[model samples]
Target: MSTSLQVGKILNNNNRITSGEIMGSSREGGGRGAEEDEFLLQIPEASAKVPKDAFHLAYIFYFTLGAGFLLPWNAFITAVDYFTYLYPEVSVDRVFAVTYMLVCLLFLLFIIGWAHKSSAYLRINIGLALFVLSLLIVPLTDLLYVKGTRGLYSGYYITVAAVALSGVADALVQGGVIGSAGELPKRYMQATVAGTAASGVLVSVMRIITKAIYPQTANGLRSSANLYFSVSIVVMVICLVCYNMADRLPVIQYYRDLKMQAMNEESKEKGPLSGSAWRSTLWDIVGRVKWFGFGIFLIYVVTLSIFPGYITEDVQSLLLKDWYPILLIAGYNVFDLVGKSLTAIYLVDNANVAVAACIARLLFYPLFLGCLHGPTFFRTEIPVTVLTCLLGLTNGYLTSVLMILAPKVVPLQCAETAGIVIVLFLILGLAVGSVVAWFWVI
Candidate 1:
């Protein structure tokens, strides 16, 4: 039995599963699904001759939007040198992780509850505007107040507030984009997921260029950090424009119309949408996809605890010096991109194996620890760098696989809410993992 089957069927009456959901998950990895030939009927959009994706514009837009949402986060974390210099007393990375993830998680819960009533369109537009504002905070603060000085503690608090603001923006954008993409085909979900890795890679590249061009001085770190936010701001503007225009695209609208049709049918059958009706439906959707959420939760709990925090703070290198963390981060980002993009070629259909892999990633904690406290050779740069890349690779692949699978488990109409629930679990994992990163001393 599949993991979903083993846990519990989504419906005993088989009313919830639709043809698109079946085909999306089943035809994966070239597996001929059970009795799929019998149910090879078309969903609403599929019933009509599917409109062309129009030079794959919708796909590219989604990919870019995926990349867009994470850029601010990457900017803040990758600017650790600047933040650390300004506030030497702080555990900069862990604190940022906690602040960002928790705020995002808390706001995400509210967004999920209010999601059916509000427009994701408005939420995303507001989010992109906030991203622009938050990305501007650090550089502007430094220019106006901090200068190149060290130990100005006021700057630290301002920076933390900016990080929290970015967290709120992330909750709005990530849930909306993922939820919207979930309403489409699985490949678009892969595009969105892969684009997330691309954001990491883009920031890493910026780190390389900035780290190389500037002299290794206090002034150099500040310049690099400002440059990071500057580029992020440009990307945010582009995303805002693109996302607003995305609603007009014929390909995107076709799917939106189909979802609306399904929703209307649902409303007609069940009467007007009341708060009570939504609450019951919300719980039902959550129950259907809880196992998938558990896997997503586990994935981030393992990843966030180790990455950026451990990669930047726990280890060191004589030759690489400050460059060591930059290079390690770059390597992880590259492999992460590779892993996320791999779903385009082949995906794991077996949920049992996918979830087990997430659990197996706990082994990374011991392996990374070995790099710090083990034998002389193991403590060297090569092993640590390799481990970091491996961490990124696993994190990317499993995240994409499970995200793509989660929405497919429910009926088409509930797919968007399922996606939002999965993202809530994702942020929840990040919040927990940030706390866990502190316990790394054990």
Candidate 2:
């Protein structure tokens, strides 16, 4: 059969699966049941038709826009103590911890709402609006607080709101509310990879910018808090505007109609999976896939231990010596961007998800460890530079593969919940890693 026919058949099979209909017989009836099971495992003909343009646009938004904000924020939190000249004597760790806790709570709330079948659109809009509002409030707090005492609280609040917004956005985009038009024509798996790459690029660029414009004071390090606050405010506003524009696009309605049609067809072919059954299935999948989660956790822990020790120290030293760190930062980001971008493209075009993930992990494990603890680690800065580049590459690939594969590992209805669980695990790993680093002085 032609590829199109094959795709159509697969889609039909998926529709059947979406409904509660079982394709194979029970094991109690051994011979026929075994035959049916073997038949069902065969690849179906129908496949999802993903649009190139829509997929590309989604990629740009996720990588260039969403990631642009997220990555810098991550790096910034890690180096906030060094940038305290912008705020003074405040415990950056405390602020970050509080913010992270709030974000986690908010994510839990979102998961609860989703489980109850609440309007994801409303939840997403409210979350994103609050996030932007918080960002706007940051610069204002700086303007108002002459003593700078309140700035810490303001920063913490903003960071919390930002993290909440990210979680909301992820849910919204994945659930087909906000980015549906951009996503409808694309394969969910490929879109995920693209999004991850975008995030990597964003982080790289933000770090570079921080290094370039970092203003040094007599205390210890250059303070880019104001720059971060200002840029974030601008980006938040831009995102709000873009979101509004997206809302107004006629394509959104079309996309929604198509999505509803798909859902309706799925519902008609097979009854919806019951809540209990879905929950059970989700847990079962998680149990089966625990190894992937553990691997990801290890990667995050490794990053937490090594990145802060090397990158922060390097940036601070350069700033103190009046050397521009932008070039290094840019180089790091470029490598990261390339790695993620390539990985994403490969996953989409080639469909070798497991292989891609393994490649990323293999590269990261040795490169990241060597960078932090290697003999020539900091000698002449060459090793540090190479490590940074490698870190960017490995992280970029790992993040992309993880995000892309996450939703696929479970039922479509549970994709958002899965993503949330993954995020929580990642955060926990980061916390544990940071503590270990602090205690061992590694």
Candidate 3:
């Protein structure tokens, strides 16, 4: 199933894939010996060549940075009940989603369209700082402003502002980390994805702990919110530190050097890119990986269609009651994490097969719709939970695979641009899915 395993199968078939071009030489000039050489080349290059043994550390930090960027967002989403309690009259959940997506989409367009050439490190650091501030704003407002005013409007508006800030932060970190990982080897991309899934797991665990330890009273809920946000803030600080340290690591520096060399070569070949050139670059990336882009777009479209709000609101378990949604969401996060991490062991490298699999995710829509309005058995908790796990697994694995492979399909200089384009497609999918999600209410 994995590309690595497929390599051996291809070798047994007499190295027909690359026509033995990968092989150096053989006794027959194209026999088993040459085939073995070709097989060796297909093995992923290890990051061990990174100077001073910092490669693994840098590699891990990329994962952490990825997880870190999504943690705050996850924490907020997981605390949906808390937000609902604070602002009973408002549709805080949908409001936050709308505001967050809008801000992230706008800022992402600006970054890629105009500031794509800027420093990723600088942007990410600022983003991390903003993320920390966003987390702090909620509690700080509750502590300083809410108690004095006793008006729900003040806290609600403050929470909305905090959500907006988180969106802006997401745009910075998502763009920077994804773009950076895209330029590096495939493994880093996997790491980043695994990290994102891990964030969900981490936040899910935190919620479970807080819910169990605290009483079910209003005070208990408030206390849990404080503790959760406090921990998220601390995690953001660590993420900031790890990101800066990773930048100085020898392995990261090696990639930086490679990127610089590629940029220098491109600059020499073509003078500075004008406005028209920027537009052309986008079209070029689209033309090169339209299917890959479509695959990514559909992947998120199907995923966002059912995740978070849909799962939390539309589904109910007569047995589990309050714990039903929580457990189902946790299951999704855990399996999604597993699916993403598995790619490190075995990647599906065939672009066509991968793309086709992504398109097949459309089956989820009808399947989920059936659960909502089909046979009585289909509405049961077990079936729904199982479906949720499969959805998460497929979403995580396919997204990582497409993202990891798409950029490599292009030239080195265009890889970063390609990465940005993929993110754009991903965001577009999110927007479309969010819109479609509203149909659940109708």
Candidate 4:
């Protein structure tokens, strides 16, 4: 059989074994053996230089920037637009319910159809591309087609698109397309931080521009949305151009050589773990980094669902000004950038994965508590904002740590599956936490 076929089989078997373990089956021992066999199959028989693909870097930057632009502002824009116009009566519970429902549906689709696995990279890139396109088009649709019709459906569509984009981005990052399993290069994390920081700056600038250009508007949601779409379109276009140009670079040639070498190695392997070991070898890979996954889920549950709306609502209630809210958003992103950069660089350099993960997870508890009660404890602007900024920092650091640790929890072959599983938990946790927070509000 061909080397690719053999390696594919090993990876398939590994996946099966891992799934069994996740399901609480007792076939973990066999899973481990399958994993080892798959690993051996992947190693090249002859030493070869590692590929330094230029497109790899370009893609990393592209996706990293996409992440930055997508993560912080997507929902915020929707919320801003929705609340600015219609449904002031809509409770936070409804927001959480809508988001949770969409995420759950997507996760279900992922599991039942193996959609994430089947079209991993395609799904991710397409999703991001669509999000950028949607941001650009939605406003136009509102202007032309909808013509002042801003209802739940419009908000729902926008929110669904944004959330789906996030899901796909998370999957891609987890799949090792951007950064592989094991130790990640510092440059990648740096790109992510830089992208996030850039997004914050852009949003702030965009707000100013929108306010200046369209002073007649009561709220800047539509203007901000327009700016977001335009900026994203430009950024994505640049990324696509760079990605194409990168194909011609010498680095790509090196990468192709390395890839070919690995393929040759896999062709020679033949065993239970060879050429379809992914299923069987999955659990052994996960067992090594299970704690990291659990910690991540805990962090997400506390952070994404509960903290965001809590912070936004509290600050809005207190300050009651649009400018302050925008500043807070920018401040949070800036702190997040700094925190993520520091954590990624530090952990990549010195700390063990578990230690790094634990520290990151522990930091979330304080942030969570602050979000839960900081408003009540501190009635003043300086103190409340400070706590909010700290929460941002913690969130930034934890986000980076989780991204780094995710790939480590599984072998390279099944990195995609590992990412999918991790994201499943993230979605589940966020959904549950959002629901719980809504209940608390009630």
The top-ranked prediction according to lDDT is: 1
The clash tally of candidate 1 reads 0
Could you tell me the TM-score of candidate 3? 0.87
Q: What is the lDDT of residue 385 in candidate 3?
A: 88
The candidate, 1 or 4, that scores higher on lDDT is: 1
**Winning model by TM-score:** 1
Regions of candidate 3 where Cα sits further than 4 Å from its true position: 1-55, 147-151
lDDT (tens digit, per residue) of candidate 4 on 189-287:
345544655565566566656655765343455555555666666765564454345444544343333333333433444333432464445555456
The candidate with the higher lDDT, 3 or 4, is 3
Cα shift from native, residue 258, model 1 (Å): 1.2
TM-score of each: 0.91, 0.67, 0.87, 0.68
lDDT of 2 by residue, 243-333 (tens): 5554444433433443344445545565674587556655754663355456556666666555544454533343335342444555556
lDDT of 4: 0.49
lDDT tens string, model 3, 1-442? 4432333443444322221122111111113444445544553331223344243786689889878989988878777777777778887777777788778888988888765568888888999999999999988987887743334787888789999999999988888888787777667788888999999999889888887888876677777877878988999999999998888876567556645544554555566766887788668767877888899899987888788777888888888888888898899999999889989878897989999999899898888888898999999987898899999999889988888887776655567767777887887788777776656531
**Each model's backbone clash number:** 0, 12, 0, 40
| lDDT for residue 245 in candidate 3, whole number 0-100 | 89
Tens-digit lDDT string for candidate 1 (127-231): 999999999988999999999788888889999999999999999999999988888877789999999999999999998998789986898988999899999
